[model samples]
Target: MAIALNTKLAEGVQKAAAEAGLAVVNGQESAGFNGIPTEKYTLALVSAPEGHTFTLELSAGFDITAANIAPAVRAYLLESAKRLTNPRPDVFVTLGGLPVSFTNWQWPFHLSVSGADTYVVHGGATLEDGKTAADQYLKAKVSASMTVTFAEVVAAPEQPFAEGFIYNAVRKILDQGQMELTKSGGNRQVVPVTTRYYSAKQGKFIFNDTTAQQRADYLLSKIYWLSGVLGGGAPVWIADPRDAQYLNTTVEELKKTAESLAGEGILKLDPKFEYASSTEPLMAHHAEYEHHLQDALDFTRPTFNEEMRAGHTNM
Candidate 1:
Protein backbone atom coordinates (compact mmCIF):
# COMPACT_ATOMS: atom_id res chain seq x y z
CA MET A 1 0.00 0.00 0.00
CA ALA A 2 1.20 3.48 -0.84
CA ILE A 3 1.30 6.02 1.96
CA ALA A 4 -0.21 9.41 1.12
CA LEU A 5 1.42 12.65 2.18
CA ASN A 6 -0.21 14.52 5.01
CA THR A 7 -1.18 17.70 3.20
CA LYS A 8 -1.75 19.63 6.39
CA LEU A 9 1.74 18.96 7.69
CA ALA A 10 3.32 19.49 4.29
CA GLU A 11 1.67 22.88 3.90
CA GLY A 12 2.58 23.92 7.41
CA VAL A 13 6.19 22.84 6.96
CA GLN A 14 6.51 24.50 3.57
CA LYS A 15 5.16 27.81 4.79
CA ALA A 16 7.30 27.71 7.90
CA ALA A 17 10.43 26.80 5.99
CA ALA A 18 9.92 29.58 3.49
CA GLU A 19 9.54 32.19 6.20
CA ALA A 20 12.70 30.87 7.84
CA GLY A 21 14.65 31.35 4.56
CA LEU A 22 14.58 27.65 3.91
CA ALA A 23 13.00 25.48 1.21
CA VAL A 24 11.54 22.03 1.36
CA VAL A 25 13.25 20.68 -1.68
CA ASN A 26 11.84 17.21 -1.27
CA GLY A 27 9.93 14.94 1.08
CA GLN A 28 9.40 11.23 1.30
CA GLU A 29 7.20 8.85 3.23
CA SER A 30 8.73 6.20 5.40
CA ALA A 31 7.45 2.95 6.81
CA GLY A 32 8.62 3.86 10.28
CA PHE A 33 10.29 6.52 12.38
CA ASN A 34 13.38 5.73 14.47
CA GLY A 35 12.54 2.03 14.10
CA ILE A 36 9.01 2.22 15.48
CA PRO A 37 6.51 1.07 12.91
CA THR A 38 4.44 4.07 11.82
CA GLU A 39 4.13 6.38 8.83
CA LYS A 40 6.77 9.12 8.78
CA TYR A 41 7.24 12.17 6.61
CA THR A 42 10.87 13.28 6.34
CA LEU A 43 11.51 16.63 4.73
CA ALA A 44 14.77 17.60 3.12
CA LEU A 45 15.30 21.29 3.81
CA VAL A 46 17.86 23.57 2.21
CA SER A 47 19.05 26.94 3.47
CA ALA A 48 19.47 29.38 0.66
CA PRO A 49 22.58 31.41 -0.31
CA GLU A 50 24.78 28.97 1.64
CA GLY A 51 22.83 25.94 0.43
CA HIS A 52 23.31 24.00 3.67
CA THR A 53 20.87 21.12 3.90
CA PHE A 54 19.35 19.05 6.71
CA THR A 55 16.53 16.60 7.23
CA LEU A 56 13.53 16.91 9.55
CA GLU A 57 11.60 13.78 10.47
CA LEU A 58 7.97 14.34 11.32
CA SER A 59 5.64 11.64 12.54
CA ALA A 60 2.14 11.27 11.19
CA GLY A 61 0.84 11.33 14.73
CA PHE A 62 1.13 15.14 15.12
CA ASP A 63 -2.21 16.92 15.42
CA ILE A 64 -1.49 18.85 12.27
CA THR A 65 -5.14 19.25 11.45
CA ALA A 66 -5.50 21.55 14.48
CA ALA A 67 -5.51 25.28 13.74
CA ASN A 68 -3.05 26.09 16.55
CA ILE A 69 -0.48 23.80 15.00
CA ALA A 70 0.46 26.32 12.34
CA PRO A 71 2.11 28.72 14.75
CA ALA A 72 3.94 25.93 16.53
CA VAL A 73 5.22 24.59 13.25
CA ARG A 74 6.44 28.04 12.23
CA ALA A 75 8.28 28.55 15.50
CA TYR A 76 9.91 25.16 15.26
CA LEU A 77 11.07 25.70 11.68
CA LEU A 78 12.73 29.01 12.57
CA GLU A 79 14.62 27.50 15.49
CA SER A 80 15.49 24.49 13.40
CA ALA A 81 17.13 26.74 10.82
CA LYS A 82 19.12 28.57 13.47
CA ARG A 83 20.45 25.29 14.83
CA LEU A 84 21.57 24.12 11.40
CA THR A 85 23.66 27.26 10.90
CA ASN A 86 25.88 25.54 13.45
CA PRO A 87 28.84 23.72 11.98
CA ARG A 88 27.69 20.72 13.94
CA PRO A 89 23.96 21.09 14.43
CA ASP A 90 23.55 17.76 16.20
CA VAL A 91 26.25 18.35 18.81
CA PHE A 92 25.69 20.18 22.10
CA VAL A 93 27.99 21.01 24.99
CA THR A 94 27.50 19.99 28.58
CA LEU A 95 27.96 22.25 31.59
CA GLY A 96 31.13 20.29 32.23
CA GLY A 97 32.32 21.55 28.82
CA LEU A 98 32.10 18.16 27.16
CA PRO A 99 30.53 18.10 23.69
CA VAL A 100 28.01 15.35 23.03
CA SER A 101 26.11 14.58 19.83
CA PHE A 102 22.66 13.06 20.03
CA THR A 103 21.65 11.19 16.90
CA ASN A 104 19.07 8.71 15.57
CA TRP A 105 16.45 9.98 18.01
CA GLN A 106 12.95 8.49 17.65
CA TRP A 107 9.99 10.78 17.28
CA PRO A 108 6.46 10.93 18.80
CA PHE A 109 6.49 9.83 22.42
CA HIS A 110 5.33 6.29 23.21
CA LEU A 111 3.33 5.12 26.18
CA SER A 112 5.34 3.63 29.03
CA VAL A 113 5.16 -0.14 29.30
CA SER A 114 5.47 0.13 33.07
CA GLY A 115 2.24 2.22 33.16
CA ALA A 116 4.01 5.04 34.92
CA ASP A 117 1.66 7.70 33.52
CA THR A 118 4.32 9.04 31.18
CA TYR A 119 5.43 9.12 27.57
CA VAL A 120 8.94 8.27 26.38
CA VAL A 121 11.29 8.82 23.45
CA HIS A 122 14.46 6.92 22.67
CA GLY A 123 17.77 8.03 21.18
CA GLY A 124 21.56 7.72 21.30
CA ALA A 125 24.35 10.15 22.08
CA THR A 126 28.10 9.99 21.64
CA LEU A 127 30.81 11.97 23.35
CA GLU A 128 32.21 14.07 20.50
CA ASP A 129 35.80 14.48 21.55
CA GLY A 130 37.25 15.69 18.26
CA LYS A 131 40.67 15.01 19.70
CA THR A 132 39.85 11.36 20.29
CA ALA A 133 39.61 8.58 17.72
CA ALA A 134 36.08 7.67 16.67
CA ASP A 135 36.31 4.11 17.92
CA GLN A 136 37.42 5.30 21.37
CA TYR A 137 34.50 7.68 21.85
CA LEU A 138 31.98 7.05 24.63
CA LYS A 139 28.34 6.38 23.80
CA ALA A 140 25.00 6.05 25.60
CA LYS A 141 21.41 5.04 24.95
CA VAL A 142 19.10 7.91 25.93
CA SER A 143 15.45 7.76 26.97
CA ALA A 144 13.47 10.70 28.32
CA SER A 145 10.13 10.41 30.08
CA MET A 146 7.53 13.16 30.16
CA THR A 147 4.98 13.14 32.94
CA VAL A 148 1.35 12.95 31.83
CA THR A 149 0.70 16.29 33.52
CA PHE A 150 3.56 17.93 31.67
CA ALA A 151 2.64 16.16 28.47
CA GLU A 152 -0.87 17.50 28.51
CA VAL A 153 0.33 21.09 28.14
CA VAL A 154 2.69 20.25 25.29
CA ALA A 155 1.38 21.22 21.85
CA ALA A 156 2.67 17.97 20.49
CA PRO A 157 5.13 15.22 21.35
CA GLU A 158 7.27 16.26 18.41
CA GLN A 159 10.85 17.41 17.98
CA PRO A 160 10.08 21.05 18.57
CA PHE A 161 8.52 20.56 21.99
CA ALA A 162 10.82 17.85 23.31
CA GLU A 163 14.22 18.04 21.60
CA GLY A 164 15.52 21.19 23.25
CA PHE A 165 14.56 20.19 26.79
CA ILE A 166 15.67 16.63 26.27
CA TYR A 167 19.08 17.84 25.16
CA ASN A 168 19.28 20.19 28.10
CA ALA A 169 18.25 17.42 30.48
CA VAL A 170 20.99 15.17 29.14
CA ARG A 171 23.52 17.93 29.71
CA LYS A 172 22.21 18.42 33.23
CA ILE A 173 22.52 14.72 33.97
CA LEU A 174 26.02 14.54 32.58
CA ASP A 175 27.04 17.64 34.53
CA GLN A 176 25.62 16.23 37.75
CA GLY A 177 27.49 12.98 37.14
CA GLN A 178 24.21 11.11 37.21
CA MET A 179 24.53 9.51 33.77
CA GLU A 180 27.50 7.62 32.39
CA LEU A 181 28.73 7.67 28.77
CA THR A 182 30.86 4.61 28.30
CA LYS A 183 33.12 3.36 25.54
CA SER A 184 31.45 -0.04 25.63
CA GLY A 185 28.67 -2.02 27.28
CA GLY A 186 26.61 0.95 28.44
CA ASN A 187 23.03 0.75 29.64
CA ARG A 188 20.17 3.09 28.94
CA GLN A 189 20.20 6.52 30.63
CA VAL A 190 16.86 8.05 31.58
CA VAL A 191 16.13 11.78 31.69
CA PRO A 192 13.15 12.62 33.87
CA VAL A 193 10.83 15.12 32.17
CA THR A 194 8.87 16.82 34.90
CA THR A 195 6.81 19.96 35.46
CA ARG A 196 9.87 21.56 37.00
CA TYR A 197 11.30 21.93 33.50
CA TYR A 198 8.31 23.87 32.22
CA SER A 199 6.79 27.20 33.17
CA ALA A 200 3.04 27.20 32.72
CA LYS A 201 2.81 30.94 33.28
CA GLN A 202 5.51 31.70 30.73
CA GLY A 203 4.43 28.87 28.42
CA LYS A 204 7.99 27.82 27.77
CA PHE A 205 10.64 25.40 28.96
CA ILE A 206 13.23 26.61 31.49
CA PHE A 207 16.47 24.71 31.75
CA ASN A 208 19.30 26.94 33.00
CA ASP A 209 19.61 30.21 34.85
CA THR A 210 22.53 31.99 33.23
CA THR A 211 23.92 35.51 33.24
CA ALA A 212 25.25 37.66 30.42
CA GLN A 213 28.86 36.86 31.23
CA GLN A 214 28.02 33.15 31.46
CA ARG A 215 26.28 33.31 28.12
CA ALA A 216 29.33 35.05 26.66
CA ASP A 217 31.60 32.32 27.98
CA TYR A 218 29.35 29.65 26.51
CA LEU A 219 29.39 31.28 23.06
CA LEU A 220 33.15 31.55 23.20
CA SER A 221 33.51 27.87 24.03
CA LYS A 222 30.94 26.97 21.38
CA ILE A 223 32.94 28.76 18.73
CA TYR A 224 36.13 27.19 19.99
CA TRP A 225 34.95 23.61 19.65
CA LEU A 226 32.31 23.87 16.96
CA SER A 227 33.88 26.49 14.70
CA GLY A 228 37.57 26.95 15.40
CA VAL A 229 38.36 23.28 15.87
CA LEU A 230 35.73 21.18 14.14
CA GLY A 231 34.41 23.55 11.50
CA GLY A 232 37.76 24.90 10.25
CA GLY A 233 36.85 28.45 11.20
CA ALA A 234 33.53 28.36 9.43
CA PRO A 235 30.98 30.90 10.64
CA VAL A 236 28.25 29.42 12.84
CA TRP A 237 24.77 30.70 13.63
CA ILE A 238 24.70 32.86 16.74
CA ALA A 239 20.99 32.94 17.55
CA ASP A 240 20.49 29.28 18.27
CA PRO A 241 17.30 28.16 20.08
CA ARG A 242 19.01 25.19 21.69
CA ASP A 243 21.62 27.44 23.26
CA ALA A 244 19.00 29.99 24.24
CA GLN A 245 16.97 27.29 25.99
CA TYR A 246 20.03 25.84 27.67
CA LEU A 247 21.07 29.29 28.91
CA ASN A 248 17.55 30.26 29.92
CA THR A 249 17.45 33.32 27.71
CA THR A 250 15.99 34.59 24.48
CA VAL A 251 17.51 34.52 21.01
CA GLU A 252 17.59 38.29 20.96
CA GLU A 253 19.82 38.28 24.03
CA LEU A 254 22.18 35.84 22.40
CA LYS A 255 22.27 37.97 19.26
CA LYS A 256 23.08 41.01 21.37
CA THR A 257 25.85 39.09 23.10
CA ALA A 258 27.27 38.01 19.79
CA GLU A 259 27.25 41.62 18.65
CA SER A 260 29.14 42.55 21.81
CA LEU A 261 31.75 39.89 21.11
CA ALA A 262 32.08 41.15 17.56
CA GLY A 263 32.72 44.67 18.79
CA GLU A 264 35.56 43.38 20.96
CA GLY A 265 37.10 41.68 17.93
CA ILE A 266 36.83 38.34 19.69
CA LEU A 267 34.50 37.20 16.95
CA LYS A 268 33.88 38.13 13.32
CA LEU A 269 30.29 38.20 12.22
CA ASP A 270 29.29 37.35 8.70
CA PRO A 271 28.07 40.00 6.27
CA LYS A 272 24.53 39.34 7.40
CA PHE A 273 25.57 39.30 11.07
CA GLU A 274 23.57 36.13 11.55
CA TYR A 275 26.65 33.92 11.77
CA ALA A 276 29.88 34.34 13.74
CA SER A 277 33.43 33.05 13.42
CA SER A 278 36.28 33.00 15.89
CA THR A 279 38.94 35.65 15.58
CA GLU A 280 42.66 35.37 16.12
CA PRO A 281 42.31 36.69 19.66
CA LEU A 282 39.59 34.15 20.42
CA MET A 283 41.46 31.17 18.97
CA ALA A 284 44.56 32.36 20.84
CA HIS A 285 42.90 31.01 24.01
CA HIS A 286 43.09 27.46 22.67
CA ALA A 287 45.04 26.34 25.72
CA GLU A 288 42.35 27.61 28.10
CA TYR A 289 39.54 25.93 26.18
CA GLU A 290 41.55 22.70 26.06
CA HIS A 291 42.01 22.80 29.83
CA HIS A 292 38.25 23.21 30.27
CA LEU A 293 37.58 20.25 28.01
CA GLN A 294 39.95 18.07 29.98
CA ASP A 295 38.32 19.21 33.23
CA ALA A 296 34.88 18.30 31.88
CA LEU A 297 36.11 14.91 30.75
CA ASP A 298 37.52 14.30 34.21
CA PHE A 299 34.27 15.39 35.82
CA THR A 300 32.18 12.95 33.77
CA ARG A 301 34.52 10.01 34.34
CA PRO A 302 32.99 7.29 36.49
CA THR A 303 34.36 6.94 40.03
CA PHE A 304 34.36 3.66 41.94
CA ASN A 305 34.65 3.10 45.65
CA GLU A 306 38.16 1.76 46.16
CA GLU A 307 37.21 -0.41 49.16
CA MET A 308 34.32 -1.95 47.26
CA ARG A 309 36.49 -2.61 44.24
CA ALA A 310 38.89 -4.41 46.56
CA GLY A 311 36.01 -6.60 47.87
CA HIS A 312 36.22 -4.95 51.24
CA THR A 313 32.49 -4.18 51.65
CA ASN A 314 29.30 -6.23 52.01
CA MET A 315 25.85 -5.05 51.04
Candidate 2:
Protein backbone atom coordinates (compact mmCIF):
# COMPACT_ATOMS: atom_id res chain seq x y z
CA MET A 1 0.00 0.00 0.00
CA ALA A 2 1.31 3.42 -0.98
CA ILE A 3 0.85 5.95 1.81
CA ALA A 4 -0.41 9.25 0.38
CA LEU A 5 1.27 12.49 1.41
CA ASN A 6 -1.58 14.33 3.14
CA THR A 7 -0.98 18.08 3.35
CA LYS A 8 -3.52 18.52 6.15
CA LEU A 9 -2.01 15.72 8.18
CA ALA A 10 1.43 17.26 7.81
CA GLU A 11 0.04 20.65 8.79
CA GLY A 12 -1.63 19.21 11.90
CA VAL A 13 1.61 17.55 12.96
CA GLN A 14 3.51 20.79 12.39
CA LYS A 15 0.94 22.70 14.45
CA ALA A 16 1.24 20.23 17.34
CA ALA A 17 5.05 20.31 17.25
CA ALA A 18 5.06 24.10 17.22
CA GLU A 19 2.65 24.09 20.16
CA ALA A 20 5.30 22.06 22.06
CA GLY A 21 7.94 24.75 21.51
CA LEU A 22 9.63 22.81 18.72
CA ALA A 23 11.20 24.53 15.69
CA VAL A 24 10.02 22.79 12.54
CA VAL A 25 10.67 23.05 8.81
CA ASN A 26 8.22 21.55 6.30
CA GLY A 27 9.35 19.41 3.35
CA GLN A 28 13.01 18.79 2.42
CA GLU A 29 13.94 22.47 2.17
CA SER A 30 17.33 24.20 2.26
CA ALA A 31 18.92 26.58 4.83
CA GLY A 32 20.12 24.30 7.68
CA PHE A 33 19.61 21.53 10.18
CA ASN A 34 20.13 22.23 13.93
CA GLY A 35 21.11 25.79 12.99
CA ILE A 36 23.95 24.49 10.79
CA PRO A 37 23.58 24.56 6.99
CA THR A 38 26.26 21.80 6.59
CA GLU A 39 24.04 19.21 8.38
CA LYS A 40 20.47 18.35 7.34
CA TYR A 41 17.57 16.09 8.44
CA THR A 42 14.25 15.94 6.68
CA LEU A 43 11.03 14.18 7.72
CA ALA A 44 9.25 12.15 5.06
CA LEU A 45 6.63 9.38 4.65
CA VAL A 46 7.88 5.92 3.62
CA SER A 47 6.47 2.45 2.98
CA ALA A 48 7.75 -0.75 4.61
CA PRO A 49 9.66 -3.37 2.59
CA GLU A 50 6.58 -5.66 2.59
CA GLY A 51 4.44 -2.71 1.37
CA HIS A 52 1.87 -3.49 4.05
CA THR A 53 1.80 -0.08 5.77
CA PHE A 54 3.40 3.35 5.88
CA THR A 55 5.68 4.86 8.52
CA LEU A 56 7.16 8.30 9.24
CA GLU A 57 10.92 8.53 8.50
CA LEU A 58 13.17 11.23 9.92
CA SER A 59 16.17 10.92 7.51
CA ALA A 60 19.37 9.06 8.40
CA GLY A 61 20.74 9.52 11.92
CA PHE A 62 17.94 11.99 12.63
CA ASP A 63 17.33 10.50 16.13
CA ILE A 64 20.67 11.83 17.39
CA THR A 65 21.87 13.99 14.47
CA ALA A 66 19.21 16.71 14.79
CA ALA A 67 18.69 18.82 17.92
CA ASN A 68 15.17 19.06 19.44
CA ILE A 69 14.10 16.01 17.42
CA ALA A 70 12.86 13.99 20.41
CA PRO A 71 10.31 16.51 21.67
CA ALA A 72 9.15 17.48 18.15
CA VAL A 73 8.72 13.85 17.06
CA ARG A 74 6.91 13.07 20.28
CA ALA A 75 4.49 15.97 19.79
CA TYR A 76 3.88 14.96 16.17
CA LEU A 77 3.15 11.35 16.99
CA LEU A 78 0.81 12.25 19.89
CA GLU A 79 -1.19 14.63 17.68
CA SER A 80 -1.24 12.05 14.84
CA ALA A 81 -2.65 9.44 17.24
CA LYS A 82 -5.32 11.88 18.42
CA ARG A 83 -6.26 12.66 14.81
CA LEU A 84 -6.54 8.95 13.98
CA THR A 85 -9.34 8.61 16.54
CA ASN A 86 -11.44 10.98 14.47
CA PRO A 87 -10.58 11.57 10.81
CA ARG A 88 -11.90 14.19 8.39
CA PRO A 89 -11.32 13.71 4.67
CA ASP A 90 -12.23 17.26 3.61
CA VAL A 91 -10.32 20.43 4.47
CA PHE A 92 -11.73 23.86 5.34
CA VAL A 93 -9.90 26.93 4.10
CA THR A 94 -10.76 30.62 4.28
CA LEU A 95 -10.53 32.86 1.24
CA GLY A 96 -9.80 36.55 1.51
CA GLY A 97 -12.61 39.06 2.10
CA LEU A 98 -13.18 42.73 1.29
CA PRO A 99 -11.19 45.35 3.20
CA VAL A 100 -12.62 48.50 4.76
CA SER A 101 -11.31 51.85 6.08
CA PHE A 102 -12.82 54.86 7.84
CA THR A 103 -12.52 58.65 7.90
CA ASN A 104 -14.28 61.71 9.46
CA TRP A 105 -15.98 64.87 8.18
CA GLN A 106 -18.10 67.68 9.61
CA TRP A 107 -21.80 68.10 8.81
CA PRO A 108 -23.85 71.36 8.75
CA PHE A 109 -27.02 72.32 10.65
CA HIS A 110 -29.52 75.20 11.24
CA LEU A 111 -32.34 75.75 13.81
CA SER A 112 -34.64 78.44 15.24
CA VAL A 113 -37.11 78.93 18.13
CA SER A 114 -40.41 80.80 18.83
CA GLY A 115 -42.36 80.79 22.11
CA ALA A 116 -43.44 82.80 25.22
CA ASP A 117 -42.24 82.95 28.86
CA THR A 118 -42.86 85.33 31.80
CA TYR A 119 -39.71 86.46 33.66
CA VAL A 120 -38.57 88.99 36.29
CA VAL A 121 -35.31 90.68 35.33
CA HIS A 122 -33.81 93.29 37.73
CA GLY A 123 -37.05 93.20 39.82
CA GLY A 124 -39.12 94.25 36.82
CA ALA A 125 -42.74 93.15 36.16
CA THR A 126 -43.79 90.02 34.28
CA LEU A 127 -42.85 90.19 30.59
CA GLU A 128 -44.23 88.17 27.66
CA ASP A 129 -41.35 86.99 25.48
CA GLY A 130 -41.82 85.64 21.94
CA LYS A 131 -39.02 83.09 22.37
CA THR A 132 -38.44 80.88 25.42
CA ALA A 133 -35.73 82.20 27.76
CA ALA A 134 -33.77 78.93 27.39
CA ASP A 135 -33.63 79.29 23.61
CA GLN A 136 -32.32 82.84 23.85
CA TYR A 137 -29.72 81.77 26.42
CA LEU A 138 -28.48 78.93 24.21
CA LYS A 139 -28.40 81.17 21.12
CA ALA A 140 -26.15 83.66 22.86
CA LYS A 141 -24.07 81.15 24.87
CA VAL A 142 -23.42 78.37 22.28
CA SER A 143 -22.47 78.27 18.64
CA ALA A 144 -25.19 78.35 15.99
CA SER A 145 -24.35 74.72 15.10
CA MET A 146 -21.74 72.31 16.45
CA THR A 147 -19.54 70.10 14.29
CA VAL A 148 -20.68 66.46 14.23
CA THR A 149 -18.35 63.67 13.04
CA PHE A 150 -19.09 59.94 12.51
CA ALA A 151 -15.63 58.33 12.68
CA GLU A 152 -15.72 57.33 16.36
CA VAL A 153 -19.34 56.35 16.14
CA VAL A 154 -18.62 53.87 13.36
CA ALA A 155 -15.55 52.44 15.10
CA ALA A 156 -17.28 51.93 18.44
CA PRO A 157 -17.15 48.31 19.58
CA GLU A 158 -20.76 48.34 20.67
CA GLN A 159 -23.61 49.02 18.28
CA PRO A 160 -23.36 52.58 16.97
CA PHE A 161 -25.25 55.23 19.07
CA ALA A 162 -25.92 52.66 21.81
CA GLU A 163 -23.97 54.83 24.29
CA GLY A 164 -26.59 57.61 23.96
CA PHE A 165 -23.92 60.31 23.61
CA ILE A 166 -25.51 62.08 20.66
CA TYR A 167 -29.02 61.64 22.02
CA ASN A 168 -27.98 63.00 25.41
CA ALA A 169 -26.39 66.06 23.85
CA VAL A 170 -29.53 66.80 21.84
CA ARG A 171 -31.75 66.27 24.89
CA LYS A 172 -29.61 68.52 27.09
CA ILE A 173 -29.92 71.35 24.63
CA LEU A 174 -33.58 71.04 23.57
CA ASP A 175 -35.42 68.92 26.17
CA GLN A 176 -33.83 69.50 29.60
CA GLY A 177 -36.04 71.86 31.62
CA GLN A 178 -34.88 75.44 32.24
CA MET A 179 -35.72 77.84 35.10
CA GLU A 180 -38.01 80.53 33.57
CA LEU A 181 -40.55 82.94 35.09
CA THR A 182 -44.13 82.34 36.29
CA LYS A 183 -46.59 84.55 38.21
CA SER A 184 -48.03 83.02 41.40
CA GLY A 185 -50.31 84.96 43.73
CA GLY A 186 -49.49 88.31 42.02
CA ASN A 187 -45.78 87.70 42.60
CA ARG A 188 -43.16 86.75 39.99
CA GLN A 189 -41.79 83.24 40.74
CA VAL A 190 -39.06 81.33 38.89
CA VAL A 191 -40.45 77.89 37.92
CA PRO A 192 -39.11 74.96 35.97
CA VAL A 193 -40.31 74.84 32.34
CA THR A 194 -40.03 71.41 30.66
CA THR A 195 -41.52 72.36 27.26
CA ARG A 196 -39.21 73.05 24.26
CA TYR A 197 -40.32 75.94 22.03
CA TYR A 198 -37.78 75.45 19.23
CA SER A 199 -38.71 73.70 15.97
CA ALA A 200 -35.60 72.43 14.15
CA LYS A 201 -36.33 71.79 10.47
CA GLN A 202 -32.83 71.10 9.09
CA GLY A 203 -30.76 70.70 12.21
CA LYS A 204 -30.22 68.28 15.14
CA PHE A 205 -32.95 68.49 17.78
CA ILE A 206 -34.08 66.49 20.77
CA PHE A 207 -37.51 65.94 19.24
CA ASN A 208 -37.77 66.32 15.50
CA ASP A 209 -40.12 64.95 12.82
CA THR A 210 -40.84 61.28 13.55
CA THR A 211 -42.50 60.40 10.24
CA ALA A 212 -41.53 57.11 8.56
CA GLN A 213 -40.01 58.95 5.60
CA GLN A 214 -37.89 61.15 7.87
CA ARG A 215 -36.66 58.12 9.84
CA ALA A 216 -35.75 56.36 6.59
CA ASP A 217 -33.84 59.42 5.40
CA TYR A 218 -31.91 59.58 8.67
CA LEU A 219 -30.97 55.87 8.46
CA LEU A 220 -29.94 56.17 4.81
CA SER A 221 -27.72 59.18 5.56
CA LYS A 222 -25.94 57.21 8.33
CA ILE A 223 -25.45 54.35 5.87
CA TYR A 224 -23.97 56.80 3.40
CA TRP A 225 -21.60 58.09 6.06
CA LEU A 226 -20.42 54.55 6.88
CA SER A 227 -19.89 53.67 3.23
CA GLY A 228 -18.08 56.92 2.39
CA VAL A 229 -15.78 56.83 5.40
CA LEU A 230 -14.98 53.11 5.00
CA GLY A 231 -14.19 53.76 1.33
CA GLY A 232 -11.32 56.13 2.26
CA GLY A 233 -13.47 59.29 2.05
CA ALA A 234 -14.22 58.59 -1.62
CA PRO A 235 -17.62 57.73 -2.99
CA VAL A 236 -18.28 53.96 -2.86
CA TRP A 237 -20.18 52.15 -5.58
CA ILE A 238 -22.14 49.33 -4.00
CA ALA A 239 -25.26 47.41 -4.75
CA ASP A 240 -28.45 48.54 -3.02
CA PRO A 241 -28.86 45.35 -0.96
CA ARG A 242 -25.13 45.19 -0.08
CA ASP A 243 -25.28 41.36 0.05
CA ALA A 244 -22.32 38.94 -0.45
CA GLN A 245 -22.58 38.94 -4.22
CA TYR A 246 -18.89 39.69 -4.70
CA LEU A 247 -17.81 36.80 -2.45
CA ASN A 248 -20.09 34.37 -4.29
CA THR A 249 -18.77 35.52 -7.67
CA THR A 250 -15.15 35.16 -6.49
CA VAL A 251 -15.83 31.63 -5.24
CA GLU A 252 -17.32 30.66 -8.61
CA GLU A 253 -14.29 32.07 -10.44
CA LEU A 254 -11.96 30.14 -8.11
CA LYS A 255 -13.82 26.91 -8.86
CA LYS A 256 -13.35 27.56 -12.55
CA THR A 257 -9.64 28.20 -12.01
CA ALA A 258 -9.29 24.98 -10.02
CA GLU A 259 -11.00 23.01 -12.83
CA SER A 260 -8.64 24.57 -15.36
CA LEU A 261 -5.61 23.61 -13.22
CA ALA A 262 -6.90 20.05 -12.88
CA GLY A 263 -7.30 19.81 -16.67
CA GLU A 264 -3.65 20.87 -17.02
CA GLY A 265 -2.64 17.97 -14.69
CA ILE A 266 -1.02 20.37 -12.24
CA LEU A 267 -3.40 19.36 -9.42
CA LYS A 268 -6.29 17.04 -8.63
CA LEU A 269 -9.57 17.33 -6.73
CA ASP A 270 -11.32 14.25 -5.38
CA PRO A 271 -14.75 13.54 -6.85
CA LYS A 272 -16.27 13.65 -3.34
CA PHE A 273 -14.78 17.07 -2.59
CA GLU A 274 -17.18 19.95 -3.11
CA TYR A 275 -16.99 23.71 -2.75
CA ALA A 276 -18.63 25.16 0.39
CA SER A 277 -20.29 28.55 0.73
CA SER A 278 -20.15 30.81 3.80
CA THR A 279 -23.14 32.87 4.90
CA GLU A 280 -21.46 34.52 7.87
CA PRO A 281 -20.97 38.28 7.71
CA LEU A 282 -17.49 39.39 6.63
CA MET A 283 -17.12 41.88 9.50
CA ALA A 284 -18.21 39.31 12.09
CA HIS A 285 -15.57 36.89 10.81
CA HIS A 286 -12.89 39.54 11.30
CA ALA A 287 -14.05 40.31 14.85
CA GLU A 288 -14.16 36.61 15.70
CA TYR A 289 -10.56 35.83 14.65
CA GLU A 290 -8.89 39.11 15.62
CA HIS A 291 -7.92 37.92 19.11
CA HIS A 292 -7.56 34.22 18.36
CA LEU A 293 -3.83 33.52 18.92
CA GLN A 294 -2.10 30.26 19.89
CA ASP A 295 0.40 30.05 22.73
CA ALA A 296 2.93 27.19 22.96
CA LEU A 297 2.58 26.93 26.73
CA ASP A 298 -1.18 26.55 26.42
CA PHE A 299 -0.72 23.27 24.54
CA THR A 300 2.33 22.11 26.53
CA ARG A 301 0.75 22.49 29.99
CA PRO A 302 -0.28 19.18 31.52
CA THR A 303 -4.08 19.12 31.60
CA PHE A 304 -5.48 15.59 31.69
CA ASN A 305 -4.01 12.24 32.78
CA GLU A 306 -4.91 10.58 29.48
CA GLU A 307 -3.22 13.32 27.47
CA MET A 308 -0.12 13.15 29.71
CA ARG A 309 -0.03 9.39 29.27
CA ALA A 310 -0.23 9.78 25.50
CA GLY A 311 2.57 12.36 25.52
CA HIS A 312 4.79 10.11 27.64
CA THR A 313 4.10 7.11 25.44
CA ASN A 314 4.99 9.10 22.33
CA MET A 315 8.19 10.33 23.98
Best by the TM-score measure: 1
Candidate 1 C-alpha lDDT tens digits along 101-213: 88877777877778789888888888876787988888888888888878888877877666778888888778777777778828777889787878899987787788889
Query: Which runs of model 1 end up more than 4 angstroms from their true locations?
Result: 1-19, 24-37, 41-53, 61-65, 271-273, 306-315
Clashing pairs in 2: 115-130
Candidate 1 matches the true fold with a TM-score of: 0.85
Please, what is the whole-model Cα lDDT of each candidate in the order they appear?
0.75, 0.25
How many clashing residue pairs appear in each of the predictions shown? 0, 1
Model 1, poorest ten-residue lDDT window?
A: 36-45
| Candidate 2 runs further than 4 Å off | 1-55, 64-67, 89-92, 95-315
Please state every model's RMSD to the true fold in angstroms: 3.5, 32.7
lDDT of 2 by residue, 1-315 (tens): 122333443444445444533323333322221222111222222221222111232322223212443454453444333222211101101111111111110111111122222211111111111123533321111122222232222222111111122222222332222212223313322221122312235322233323433322222222222222122222221111111111222223334443443354433333421221111232233332222211211222235576666676655
